[model samples]
Target: MNSTLLLKKLYKRNLQPVLTDLKFAIALLLIIALFSITGTVIEQGETLDFYEANYPLHPALFGFLSYKVILAIGLNHVYSTWWFLSILVLFGTSLIACTFSRQLPMLKVARRWSHYTRAKSFEKLPLSTALEGRSLDQLAPVLAQKGYRLFQTDDKLYARKGLVGRIGPIIVHASMILILLGAIGGALTGFVAQEMIPSGQTFAITNITEAGIWARPWLPKDWLVRVNRFWIDYTPGGTIDQFYSDLSVLDKDGNEVDRKTIHVNEPLRYKGVTLYQANWDVAAIRFQVNQSPIIQLPMTKLQDVNNKAKAWGTWLPTKPDLSAGVTLITPDLQGTFLIYGTDGQLMDTIRVGGSSEINGVTVKLKDVIGSTGLQIKADPGVPIVYAGFGLLMLGVVMSYVSYSQIWALQVGDRLYVGGKTNRAQVGFEAELLEIIDRMAGSTPSLSAV
Candidate 1:
């Protein structure tokens, strides 16, 4: 018995700090929010050179945040860091402690009733009224219609509504815990890889940019992805409208398993892996020289795509004299190129399936081959995350309900009624007046007819 008492005391002591001091939970929330912002601000899983070039040391970011600091603190990948996850775990622990130590017991207390055997007990309620020689039968149906549950005995009665409101906070806490578990599960098992494949090329997932420590077992090892075709649709004003890539999943024996035509926001999924069409590039241009064999020339972008206009250009030797060549430039994958002559003169604008004479030869533009940039991801916790979000929304709506209760007692020739509510003060008062009116307004006694 002494040992049991000691263990109980220790448990109570440990529980008091976590339950009484809410500051720790609040602080954890603020830190998580601040670091989530940092995750968005600082790019994740970038190369050392990328960080060095973008966040250089010569003029470090924000005066003190340098590449060295970011690397050392793991700011480059904050979401998966040990410290951030530890904070989430601590916050969840506090929630569990708070739920069991306070909320559950409070709910149990809320569900119980202390019958007012003495008249003084009825007098203490926030709303109470008395009528001599009356029965409150009419009050039962009215309260029941307002969602108040009814409990009764011979000379005493109790009714309450919106008990569900008491369960909302518990559900909210549980939902948050589920969300944290989902995030942790995803971090432990998710992997993200990138592949830029030209049309007609097949590749396996190898360029992993972001992944959890335990994600290797889940990575694709038996499957191959092929970009069967890629094309871009342009607006009338010569801007991109949309780009599409037709992808096919293949087995080890090269048999096709699945296929999809995907663009932005639309992704293809197979065997827990998802492929998103994130970017597109001009890979090569196909040209035909007037009944001669077709030649495909590789294209390269002229400048950084972000800083300058999107354009890819290639050179073609049109004259056997070896002194003259044509530079073909296209602003987009519109299959239209600005043909520049060897003398640096604007020769002509050529479109796919159109022919132009230059250097005593007819140059026909055939097609422009585009490449698709695919972001491949495998996350096993997506369903759990979705379920958590659903529960969170449900808990929020349920929390709005009011847990109102009414109690009544009878003595000699007097009926005394009283009520209380956990929320909506004005509404509860209105309910009191309404109940009093119903009891007084009834033609017969307030008991069952």
Candidate 2:
């Protein structure tokens, strides 16, 4: 019994106060906000080489942040770091403690109906009046008509409404707790991957760019994604307007399960994984040399060009000994290719299915195949987070309702009336005055003081 008493005392005096302190909760919130900002400012899940090039040590970023610091502190992935998750858990516990120790008790007190039995009790209320020659019988119906719930004894009465307002803070706290749980859940189980798949090619989730510690189970292993076709829409000025990829989901038996044409901001969701059309590239060039078999050569992006326009190019040998060749260059998948001779001079221009005799050979451009860049992600907690936000908005709206209460005491010839509201004080005052006026009409001798 002595040990139990000591434990209770320690909980009440030590652990409970710190967790219930508003300042501590606010401090935790500020710390979380600061770390969230840091996460946004710093790119997450980049390669070591990328960080080395961008945040070099010779002139470190901000004179302190370098690749070494980012790796050591896990700033490369802030949300999954142990310290950040610990802070989230601590903040959630603080909210739970505050709800139990402060908000719930306040709600309980508000729910319990009590009457101001003495005239002195009326003196402390924000809105109070004493009426002479008025009984409780004359005032009860007036308050009831004004939408005030009433409780009465022979000499004391209490009436209240908008009890739901008292529950709003509790719902708000609950929603915040749900949001924290969702964040933690996502941090531990979500995964992100990227793939650049050429048209007519099928691929699986093999290149994971970023993932949580326990994200392997969430990764898709039973299905494959096939890119049926990739095409782009160009504006009148030759700029890309939009790109699209027709995709199909295949089962292990190579049967199509689902199909969709996805574009930027329009993602395909299957099971829990979402595939977004993030980028595109020129994959390969298909052509024929002098009625030979159709040959497909891989294309690569060119660098160090004078013009900054993006272009992909490949070389095609026209002679058997590789003594003569031409470079095929195209800025986009517009089926137009610029042919350059061995001396780097523009020889001719060709389109898809068009041929040109160059360097003693007939070169035919069959097609230009494009690749679709897809960003895949699986996050199990997104629905929970959305639900939490919805509840938070509802709670905020509910909290605006006014919870007003009124009390009156009848002592033979006098009635003491007092009331208070958690919100909308002016409206509550007007409502109370209207009730008084109605009671005065029934008792002509009644006068408010």
Best by TM-score: 2
Per-candidate clash tally: 3, 0
Positional deviation of 118 in candidate 2, in angstroms? 2.1
Worst 10 residues of 1 by lDDT: 440-449
All models, RMSD in angstroms: 4.5, 2.7
lDDT of 2 by residue, 1-449 (tens): 99999998998999999999999999999999999999999988878987887788979988999999998999989998999999999999999999999999999999898777678878788888878888889889988887888999999999999888988988999999999989999989999899999999999999999888889899988999999999999999999999999999999999999999999999999999999999999999999999889999999987555435688999998987888899999989999999998889999999999999998899999999999999999988788888898999988888888999888998778788888898898788778887888876442222223
Give the range where candidate 2 is weakest over 10 consecutive residues by summed lDDT: 440-449
Note the residue pairs that clash in candidate 1.
135-446, 136-446, 137-446
What are the runs in model 1 whose C-alpha is more than 4 Å off?
Answer: 1-11, 14-16, 136-146, 253-255, 287-293, 304-310, 313-330, 337-365, 440-449
Instruction: Give the per-residue Cα lDDT of candidate 1 at 176.
Output: 88
